[model samples]
Target: MFKLIIMCLKSRSNKSGVRCYQNRPSSISRSDGRRSRFGFVGGDIGDQNMWRSRPRQIHINRFPPSSKVDLRAALPKAVQGSKGEWAVDEGPTLRWGIAPVSLMADDFAAALSVLPEQHHRIVSCVAAYQSHALAFAERHQVENVYTSFEDLAKCPNVDVVYISPLNPQHSELCHLMLNHDKHVLCEKPLCMTEEQVTKLLEKARARGLFLMEGMWPRCVPAYHYLRHQILRNRLGELQNVRCSLGLPVSQGRLGLYGGVTSDFGVYGMQLALWVFREVPRSLKVSGRVNSEHVDIAADIELCFTRGKRAFIEVSAERKLSNQAIIQGKNGTIKMNNYWCPTRLITEEVDFEFPLPGGDQVPPTHYHNRLGMCYEAEEVRNCILKGSNESDDFSHNESLLLANLMDTIHAELGVGEIADRKQIPDLQRQIEKVQDIVEDPEELASETCRVVQDVSSGTLETKQQEEEAPPRSKAIDAP
Candidate 1:
């Protein structure tokens, strides 16, 4: 299995509209053919303008326009798209290796199970086998299973390492596999921080080790068709793109605000930043207060350097709803279960796009693994060609996500940083990062009358449920 690991739009000062695209010049640049020779830097489609793709810098104003445009400072040296001529190689008759690294194993394991059915491509299963592992082996007629990373990593003959550790562990494990001269398909957020991400990019370049983030959204032919339609302008001028998926804190942890925004909101937030192809400039969060006056739910609003904008609402207090809605000036596209639910709705320019492109799925049938199978395939393909890193989910991309998350925490509220043991390890880092929490009274007074400090002089639990949604991680992508 490939492993990897945000707020809905909280509105503040609803009266004053935010200019989502401000300082950055240019919107989407036109490119039919005759693209730039150096697609590496200012040449590719994602380049051109900040509004059209992810912002290159953490702080937009800190650097000049030139510095901002060439965001490839830390990308892998061996730059190559999952380009053709390198179409995914046919699987080896006898499967080479298998490694499961994420909490959810259904997708990766399922992909492995099919190897025997189709081509006998996968041979061994390693890294903490779960209940499904045995059934998969039996069904696929394979016989090897490992319950430890040690055994998997130590397999000298193992051709590929299937990695799916949590967000924090992805970087080191990926590096370990690559260093072992084994190909690797680790999950998304492949590196937790920009520093670690940078390291992976360099290592991949040096070793020609295959690496790709687990983002299944790209793998589906349906999405490719969607992009094609959008590119053709058959969809018309896209006005707003909004997608959200959230769950209550898996461990019921408390975050800066009572609603626990830290753990799960990153996906939504990252999506907000990514789809717009811009960095979040000013982030806003608005929540209602209970008797204790703690923030329960927030409608988080992120204004990008470009005008493209997104809002997410996340709350533990509500039933689960994961949806994606994209509205164009002339049409709309909506999905029911973004995390692999089968139902979706697409209405455009007096026509509702059918299931071939969009539809709906009942919740009862939603049993797929955390949809990341494509990322794993990408890794295998890259390794087969002796290439390292991938066009999608480059090391820089993961690092940017981490840095962006860290930045968002700093802007919205101070995230109390603690390791798994809840021991503070980076007081200095925290201090350097998150905004200095002023007196609670200051925020209470500043936001809304509905919010107030407690009589006991402590922030309360549970804020108003705003629209801001949490980031969905692998589970969020559909």
Candidate 2:
């Protein structure tokens, strides 16, 4: 029932790099004839109809952190103290250094804003996009904006680095951070291959430093509740798991290394693997691969040896309900936005509705949505306890995820970029910026000389300090 139309120019690539043609959508129409603040249209009638027709349901149960179960028991034993309790309180307040500011970085900042002041502090911001980073720094009041990633990596006050750059640069940047002995909490899809994950994780382990993929859902209370139910067999024998997450972006292309599977399919895979706690015996996949050789839409089926199956669907070309359902012999668990689940519903029926006794978890404002802090807390606890990786979302899981995705790409013929290094050249660009910063006086004269050589063309400058509009677009996850 939810509908969105995205207009995109045909994508083209050569030896140079991926080139995306941009053209705004000429019209956005909702069936109910309503428009949002961003001029996107939507309708409540279609939403209500879709919900009423759904087989399962979801409910939000609100509970304070104090009422929640002890997370220590769910975490790895290495993060436990002498009494087998989490040593969360023993650690110093986490000082975060956010690099390569973008939309996701802003999301992290929003999540950090709600955390307890004593638990965390954002000490610095490092930006490669000069214009955008300068604007972000002024808005967030971040005083230290370093041009060099090395500077942020070496800053003694920066205990951890939150890497939120584009996908291609994740591996290189993470390697850089780990080489400097800085704990890292990187954005999802940590790297392109399991080999990369293994290498970086090995480095973290060697240094006795903490490193974790920012899988926030795994750390949220809602997911914890679901995990308890599955582990306890509250849903009876597991039968099937289904997940869907779809959205429209510029011409339906996520980026160079981004498509439906890389950008959105990871959520479905993580959910399935976490629930089953086992790898599938076989996998079957079919999808639409775009001109750029990235999956535009994917439907994957993973068959387990125990007569169980998991079906996952993801896309960057349309809008879906964006929910997940786990089916079992006795009942089903339905999760809305399973990637960042805020609601959970247990229904004890195959065809009949109206269950008698079922659990419904209420949502917490910060914990449910902007809950990156939950992962941060886990990282802090692990660091204080001297653990190298989180048990909840361990390196093994990351490797599994990467390997699974790699298989999907192979089957779909989602060929790797011919010149992958040319795409998302953040490292190269940042090096140039760093060089300019390291020798500002010489670069200034050089810049003036270049300007003088350009035929004395007058440059227009706006003196008024107008606030840059907030970037509302959602970037594909790394």
Candidate 3:
């Protein structure tokens, strides 16, 4: 299933480097998220396994190692506010090259234009569609357009690779690029499973390539503003912090997703990971996962330093909620859904703290900076200055968030399922059924007749069908 094909460059060849391409077993079917029923070559299907309806299979790329390097030595340590757990360094322009990533072309185009000094520009992009990549490259004046990731690594002029592949595709793509000696900037929830993340991080460290999870929230400039305001100590000792962000889940678009956590919980987990001023000094979190999968919608409470607390609630079940409230011993600041507070309300000794303006008005100096715009600036600044990861979201914290989410799912009575029983059919004696993925044609097929095999009068069931192999749960004090 896996192999390493080594490539070599000739001493006098005009080509700068060797490119590796491993055609996947099957091409990803590009349609409205539909599964492809590729010509199922009838092989020796196990007598038992063949009876089961097949789930969609994902195509994957295999890579060969042409070269290797020790990655830990190349990292740099720079910014400091929360403390120095990560050593991010500062240096000069890194001729940046991106691969396997693209988002709203206009946003990325403008950001690249705003960047002051990046040595070289080369990128290989993948989107849901090729036209999307073409439009972005044409609009942004980027010369290269690569449809596949392997071709991107082969580009002679790349330094750093950006990975924004579809969620499941991330871990492997990241390793492929890092192996090619390029720094990486990858989008959040980089990989769904914890094992994938740990391996990616370990590989990045081993290769000495800069790798960061692109959790844009951490890069927003408002963080600087928020940090200064809090450290200014104007609000007195911070007592409790609460933040919530919710949007109408378009069931039409998101409902069929089947994975509930993908929508609502991903937002809260990402925000709660970064927004709070301090992580739990001692944290205990628990929540529930739907029977469907780890598609969870849950609440978490974090007890922080000095009796303070942080509460985070998320659910795919609702449509609208956008409020961040930071309450102090004396006053409270209510932030609009995803933005900094349009108004700050302070209190004193169980009474409202006096305002500079009228009762409904805030001080004359509140600013509303475009958030996403600022995130791009942060990425540019970090790359140009040679900082490896976003301080707001260090490489380590991203993994921690995934682990916490998993822990929360387990601690709660999430995996609970009731017993199943056979339903005797009026026409045929009996049948048993559990939830419900049916195709109209398949419903009429002989496959439906197999339901009688489980007609045992006594009900028997198993909990937690199976999960990927476990990861090392090495928890350090938060």
For all the candidates, what are their Cα RMSDs to the real structure? 19.4, 24.4, 25.1
lDDT of each: 0.42, 0.60, 0.42
The lowest-lDDT stretch of 10 consecutive residues in candidate 3 is 469-478
TM-score, per-candidate, Cα-based = 0.57, 0.66, 0.55
Best of the two (1, 3) by TM-score: 1
* Best-fitting candidate, scored by lDDT: 2
Residue runs of model 2 more than 4 Å from their true location after superposition: 1-90, 348-368, 417-472
C-alpha-based local distance difference test score of model 2: 0.60
Candidate 2 lDDT tens digits, 1-478: 1232222223332223211111121222323443311112121111111001111111111111212334333232322234653222444788888887776777676555544545677787888766776777776666678878888888888888999777767999998988888999998879876557667777877888888887877876566556545544577888999988777766443765466787788988888876775545567899997777877889999776467889998877777667788888976777665776544554421111111011222222222345565677778778887888876687756765775776688678876522211111111100110000223223222211110121232112211211121121564532
* Candidate 3 displacement at residue 34 in angstroms: 40
Superior by TM-score: candidate 2 or candidate 3: 2
Q: Higher lDDT: candidate 1 or 2? A: 2
Number of the predicted model whose TM-score against the real structure is largest: 2
The TM-score of candidate 3 is 0.55
The residue pairs in collision within model 2 are: 60-361, 60-362, 61-361, 61-362, 62-362, 188-478
Where is model 1 more than 4 Å wrong at Cα?
A: 1-103, 114-120, 127-142, 249-263, 269-275, 278-282, 285-299, 341-344, 348-366, 370-373, 412-478
| Candidate 1 residue-wise lDDT, 1-478, digit = tens | 1232112244333322112222332222113222111111111112222222322111100110111122123112122122212122255532345566233443465443322233324566655546555665564454576676666667765777666555556777787777777777665556544446557766866787666666544443223333333433444665566655445432323322223343335546644443443444445665443333333455666665435566776554554566656555655555444433222244311111111100121111123432333344455555555556554445444544554444344334443322211111111100111112223223222211222223342111211222233344323222
